[model samples]
Target: MTDRELDEILTTRWPAVMRRVIGDDSDDWMQGFVKSIARHSKRPSWRPSAKQAQLMQRLVADLSAPPEPAMELVER
Candidate 1:
């Protein structure tokens, strides 16, 4: 899938779950956070705004669920 598609999914889902999981408000770290997310999503290019990137990071942290081993390995 394309990075844009992954962006849509992250933007749409990852934040609130991250909040619940980490008890931290990532709602303010969007800029570098988005870039960080793009790196993880393995996207070649994506420039989300600071607010947008923080949101993206939250989303990434949230929807990181997987079989079992991959559950807590999102940001390594």
Candidate 2:
């Protein structure tokens, strides 16, 4: 993908995906993950490597999928 496309996806779509996947109260791991990806877009002329592109595609896929049902606790 072009740098422009990468930038657009990271800037626009990724936030929504992160919100859905991580929620408002994100943990350290999730925060670190966001920072790592954010670094690419922050740099000049950023384009994802093959592996990063694959991972980004997977994240986009997650955005399309319906949220899974929350499990209810049973009172035994």
Candidate 3:
């Protein structure tokens, strides 16, 4: 993927899931994830393998899913 595509995925698409997973630490986690992707992309033989792409696609699907209802405690 092009750098722009990667940036869009990291910045626009990934934040919601990151926020849900990391709570208040989402920004820090996102920055680190972006950095890792950049570093990997810089390697001469680096390209997203099919498995990597599939995993990312699955993550996006999971992230986009509607959250389950929160359970409420009932007093006896």
Most TM-score-accurate candidate: 2
Which window of ten consecutive residues has the lowest lDDT sum in model 3? 17-26
TM-scores for every candidate against the unseen true structure: 0.28, 0.63, 0.46
Q: Considering every candidate listed, which one attains the maximal lDDT?
A: 2
Candidate 2, 34-57: lDDT as tens digits: 667877677776667898788787
How do all the candidates rank in terms of lDDT, highest first? 2, 3, 1
Our tally of clashes for model 1 stands at: 6
lDDT of 3: 0.61
Q: What is candidate 1's TM-score against the reference?
A: 0.28
lDDT of 3 by residue, 1-76 (tens): 5666655666577656455545545567555654465467567566666765565556567788887999999999
Please provide, for model 1 over 1-76, each residue's C-alpha lDDT reduced to its tens digit, 9 standing for 90 to 100.
Answer: 4467556665665444544435643455544554455456555454555675566555565456553564464675
Judge candidate 2 against the unseen true structure and give its global Cα lDDT, from 0 to 1: 0.75
- The parts of candidate 2 lying over 4 Å away from their true place are 24-31, 70-76
Pick by TM-score: 1 or 3, better one: 3
Question: What local distance difference test score does each model get?
Answer: 0.53, 0.75, 0.61
